[model samples]
Target: MITRFEELDWQDTPIGELTLRRRTEPAVGQEIYEVRLGDEYLMSSLFTVAEEELSTLGLAAATGDDLSVLVGGLGLGYTAVTALHDDRVTSLTVVDRLGAVIGWHQRLLLPVSAELVEDPRTSLVEDDFFALVRAAPAEGEGDYSAILLDVDHSPRHQLDPTHADLYTVDGLRSLDRHLATGGVFALWSDDPPDEDFLETMRAVFDGVVAHVIDFANAVTGGTSSNTVYVARSRTAGEPASDRPSKAGS
Candidate 1:
């Protein structure tokens, strides 16, 4: 039998004080894993439906086999692991700003950590996903077929104020340079669909859709929903060759 709760690991990161913990859920009578940054709850194993759907809905929009995927956030590993479930995905690069989060998976501290770390298609890269999207990849590296982002709370609320720019039209254009032609860009947001952000995405992408994923809420005993914004990289009358070919290593 496990104790009611246990702190698995703790680290002082440049962002904040990060902590991983495991606890027994009395309602479900099962162990739950959670990660917290400072006073905010970053992820909970109990509520991963939306996270998994972020990968599912994103990849569904992508076209082509042997897809290369770049995941902007590595939380409980559900998003990355779910992306690998698709046989079409040949390579997956998961980037997180904090190295401590990557260490949790490398150490197999979380239940799904081993699955992500052991998968040959997966590469755990420690870097700022936001920064990488705006920069060029290494010489041999290529653009990704899909970029799934789950970092900020929403287009309006960010974990860090510096992330505000990524929600803007200019910032999105910089990110657009990192995707292959017809590639997909998907984002997970805690809030409902924002019309303003939707307009912002449309300025760069050919088509954009916001998918609301509803799931059972164990804590609330009701249904909760999260929005996944899926955008295709090709714009109207834009030649495929005109788009920039760049990605982060």
Candidate 2:
């Protein structure tokens, strides 16, 4: 049996209907928070291993002091909060296209929401992550120390159709322009590693690593897995187009 603590917040978005609900699991006596996009579940507090790792591994490969990070999605506040846990992260900008998702955190509708808002280093940005990343960088300026992106399901399958291009060589070049020297860019994928996507990352960044994350699913009573792709930027003069193309390689 389950008990709902508050009325569900539902909103119609350009993409679909977004809903936030709070509940208590009587079986375990645990408070649970969930976010759903239409009929599909976006995130749940119960499954956070991969979301947390998106930050852990993103910063682990980053080489810098007082690192500034940009998290692409604010789902359940797991990735943003995890990044703040690291002492090296001086600041984090959590960006999402959906204002409702950001508002849920602002209104404390979710359990992890408070932790993200209370942290001085954390700033909630309500904007499309792709648009922000693709914008041209200011002259003689670097944007972020690390970028942890979980906006889509995977490189091949995107929550939005426009995201598919971002996984390609031309699209990755746009993101590479904003990274600081040796900065890391990590992506979380629901499916296993894709060779084409890995090649695209390799062509754009210097160091590329694909991590397959495995965790047990209590609801399904079976093992589940996700993939994390991490890559580091190169110094000046190494433009993405200059490198060998993933298609040719």
Candidate 3:
């Protein structure tokens, strides 16, 4: 009988808990857990296809100079780092609710993500993404050229329940308000969303499109993949009725 090499027990590192376990021959990648929550898979570097897709969409939407962008969920900072690489982006705002995650990024993940956060155009906001989008400037404020969201595992599989509200009717409406004319909204999902979710996006925006990126293991270089959704705004030549109407006297 043949045996595969077994490594040390999973260690809960500061960045995120990492487990070294063996699975069937078909499943052969490191499993990562969220240390603070325990038993939740945050994500592994093994699958970064979605992250790259997000960067691609964000840059495309930012067609002009001095483009401003808002990215929700810092994660491993893959998407943010990619966004910062573009010179057209004048400002990059990153919002994440977990301080621990931020700490981990600063401590352990800095070597990989520091440039993205330390760049002159980067600003880190420790707050709830929902509140920030909902409470945006009332009117005449400059809207973001792109809003990239990766809060949940995907639209169908959310890591946190509170995030479900983000896809709701009111939630979509609020998201549309934050985009500049001709801005784009991009979402990263572990899997494809349901038909209704797609419909909701269409209702909120004039046009919507979905794109999927396949991934491969960097270690073994095998074929494995993930999906990402990119929804562009229909803001061209359209007046800003998306914002709330002022109260009548």
Best by lDDT: 1
Rank by TM-score (best first): 1, 2, 3
lDDT of 2 by residue, 1-249 (tens): 657565469999989999888777564468777888999988878779999998998899987688989899998899899999999999888889999889988988777789899999988988988976678877854568999999898888899998777888888889988888788899998988888788878878876778878888766778898888888887777655444423210
Question: Clashing residue pairs, candidate 1?
Answer: 137-247
Writing each residue's lDDT as its tens digit, candidate 1 over 1-249 gives 544989999999888999999999876779999889999998899999989999998999999987999999998899999999999999999999889889999999999999999999999999988888667666767478999999999999998888899999898888888888888999999999888898788778866878888899887889898898998898446743433222110
lDDT scores in order? 0.87, 0.84, 0.67
lDDT tens digits, residue span 1-249, model 3: 233444323455533554433222334434422222356656555456678678777577556887898899887678888888888888898898766556655654433456765688988777888777777556765388889988787776766666677787788778878888778788877765456677777667654656656666655667554555566676566743454222110
Candidate 2 yields a Cα-based lDDT of 0.84
TM-score of each: 0.92, 0.90, 0.76
lDDT of 3 at 41: 53
**What is the model-wide C-alpha lDDT for candidate 3?**
0.67
Candidate 3's displacement at residue 131, Å, is 2.3
Report, for all candidates in order, the number of backbone clashes.
1, 0, 2
Off by over 4 Å in 2: 2-7, 25-29, 139-142, 238-249
* 10 residues in a row with least lDDT, candidate 3: 240-249
Clashing pairs in 2: none
